[model samples]
Target: MSPLSPVLDGPLQRSWPWLLAGALIYLSFGFTEMMGSDLWWHIAAGREVIQQGSPWLVDDWSFTEQGSAWHNHEWLADLLFYGWVRVFGVASLVIWKWSLIIATFCLFQQLLTRISGNALAALLACTAAVAIAAPFLDMRPQLYSLLGLAVLLELTLFRSPRLKALLPLFLVWVNLHGGFVFGLMVLAIVLFPWRECSLAALRRAAFTWSACALICLVNPDGLRIFCLPLVYALNADSPYRSLGEWRSPFEAGGITSAWYAYSLVIGAALSLTWLLPAVRRRVRFSPELVAIAVLSAAMSATSRRFIILWAMAFALLLAPFAGALLRQKLVQPLMLPALLALTIWGGLRVAPYSLSSGIAFHYLTAEYVFPHGLADFVEANDLQGKTFAFYNWGGYLHWRSDGALKVFIDGRANTLFDDATYLDYVTVLGARPGWIETVEDSGAELFMWPRGRNGVRLTRGLLQTGRWRLLYEDVRGVLLAREGFALPVTLRLPDDSVDTQLTAAYLASKKGDTVATLAAASRAHEQRPWGRATCTWLRRSLQANGQLREAESVMEACRAYFPSKYLR
Candidate 1:
């Protein structure tokens, strides 16, 4: 073989075919799953960058906190993702993700190809690459680190034992994503005194390590970005705790999970095997595979999310042994490329990336899915002040709502966000006293409820006794005005015709009595003291609470008796 044989090797020797194969598996796997909030947030963040011409670090539109701390570490990736989604819509976003996966496979193959000189080792390494990278198949900036780290590992570990030569690449990897911490660890591993090789290998590794640190200074945050890992890791209950990916090692379940477990198992066996009184492979796991194995295993077992760590180490471990396992004859070269092309094709087909549509994905501004319609209703009814929201709807409401409507709570889980807030949030909606307490303390001017329920005690209790005015209730959302703001209790006497009639109808509706509903709505129409507006509120309350038929009957009767053209 010539000096550049690895680069110019034959189709069977190149290992590019296996790269295509590994990437194909990932592209295929992701196609069947739904694109989660990560995709939308990327688009949303991009818009912020475009609108502000800079990164965000505070809650701009949020009514609760105007200047809460924010993090834009993945700002660059989000802008690229937003721009792509604008151009091609979801298809473009999908393509970007798939392309990253394919590139990861190609990089892993290329690195191993140079080191092992065995085409089969390159192929197996790529295969192991696919197996390990399974859980990270989302539209997250983290993908940048995933692929970059794979390339970084191959360069630092398998081929040259010199860390200095690998520093420039490490710098690029660091600037690209926070996963650079793992890359730094790889360098330090090579520089350590291990049972693997002679002093010369460590010297080469140490030099590369020094050069890489220098290159890291070129990024935007300077060296501060590199230091953030320790800070973030130590932060209490940062998604790293509750989320499964951040958990301890692999336990069981899922199609792709076992790939990580397999590598941990195989690597431990091989690393221990090196201590045998036989053929010394002149190499040992630099950072002590046993420790990484235990940690990675614990992470995998605790959360499915950190499977990336398990996969990464597995890929590095497989690089040396690829030559032995992947020596089988190439099946069909054409099929491999076909898979690669299809993987790319499928990804582009899924991500909704387009600029002119003006319709952002749910994640981009999830809080504003139907802002105009919902906001107009609130304004027309004068529904404002502190309101309650479901668990994940806080960010959405905060973004879409006007200053009048403050939220009881939206998604920001602040330690300072009083325990009363959290308790009432779950209680009020679930109809659990604290409901009234949460409602009162939030200074709630409106209670937004999901469209149809038997009788949500929080909102219904207020409406039945005239404590709240049914200010706005449509199919999308419900808005109730606290009595003092819109209508005082003195304004609504029990037998005062309109008030009595509407109150009676509300009570019957709550009791599931259809017969009494129609009769009460009739007498209520006869006593329309506030004119058409009161009648309108009655109809809206009935229809919004699943009394559409009674609302129609009241409308018909009001038209027959008063015969006003404006009612139409």
Candidate 2:
């Protein structure tokens, strides 16, 4: 019952490996990418809540979605993350992210070690879990779900089978993310025996599950926020199907750790089930293990994201069976020579693990840096006005800019912007025909793009137009603006030209004409698929169209023909 008892009462030998595993797990998160996309949108949403001093009732932040339903479901995480940024700046965000990751993995590792004495097996499970979770790793509310699941799992399996501890975890998990429902579902799986569990334990788990469901009432939005998890799937025919992470499993790689490890595990257990068919069988197939095995099997054929869920489950299930196999003298230790070869290979040949140079994933490299340079430029010139922005840059810009420039857009996404506002901006960014005109019309006095991109090929061309001028440039980025310190004619873009086509397609996709946009972009690609700007815009157009598959198709074509021109 005591928190310290797990550490203090245990001898140093057992706890040290678990603690070392914890340290290594947290170290892994250092390389995980920052949450830049929807993660930022959450921060922006939280800021509005902070300013308004009220939870979102009807949406009111953007000029676009003046009145619409906005689910600030992650209000708690948003506020906490946003507040942390305010207290310690972005460095704190990174710290918080890595800390959560380390904490989650450490807990999971502990549970796994509790079930399986093999530290190496536990390490493999966590490492494989990290690989599948790469896509979604970052500082997010959902991490709370992952961490809570570990706690929930421990209580579900290792406790007195009384199911008394489930309520408090369930209550906290509800505020963290809708992933708590997953914990309840996991509980149901662990308690699969409708007939086997004592009536008291069944009643307790049911009451705990109900209590957690009811605890959603304590959130900022009251009982309404509970609808968010369900409502998120309305437009999604199968939200899980559309989203790789939510899919049942095996969708990622059927042969992932589950099949390889789980089958090896449960198969051994099943083998023993008949081999020793005695009441005193050293290995017992608890319903929990069977249920976990079923989930693992399903997820193995689903998406890579669910690999973590089953990896931990199967690892635990395998421990007892491994011992059972050891009893029959079936388990074999590595040969001395082979063991040395593996150790040497692991150290010299394997370059993946880095205790020295921290390897960064693409998100960290692609994420927006604080625009200290641009902010300085505006402060020096004192010529600030509304500016256009990319989705990626919009969030950090909003955080650091101090309201000097009203961003043409920020990370609020389409839901916050409604159809027309989102598409209109999408149109302008694509340099669609009359995009310059659209900027002028919006009174966008300045332009800013991610540094090193050279996105606007016309940046140098604008030098002669006298309608717009290059204001500033830095190693990090650049800035441009219209003449008369006001919006005016800039370089004229061609009608139905590549830029125009890109702009139109981009906007149309935002307007929900995703298919037409994808086809148009595909047609454009047919002419010059490898063109730098064309390929660049083509990728966005594909993503906008929700044609990730087609996007990959174009990218493959571009990379095949022009290796150097890959859109990255």
Q: Largest TM-score belongs to which candidate?
A: 2
Each model's TM-score? 0.61, 0.62
- Candidate 1: list runs displaced more than 4 Å: 1-11, 32-35, 113-125, 159-176, 191-240, 243-263, 277-303, 326-388, 394-568
Which segments of candidate 2 are over 4 A away from where they belong?
1-13, 34-50, 55-62, 66-70, 117-124, 158-165, 191-204, 230-234, 237-283, 286-372, 378-386, 402-446, 451-454, 457-568
User: How accurate locally, in lDDT, is each candidate?
Assistant: 0.54, 0.55
Worst 10 residues of 1 by lDDT: 355-364
Q: Against the true structure, candidate 2 has what lDDT? A: 0.55
lDDT of 2 by residue, 436-549 (tens): 666667766677775434445535544556778776654245578777674323432233544445445655665778777766666666665655445666786778757798
Scored by lDDT, the top model is 2
Model 2 TM-score relative to the real fold: 0.62
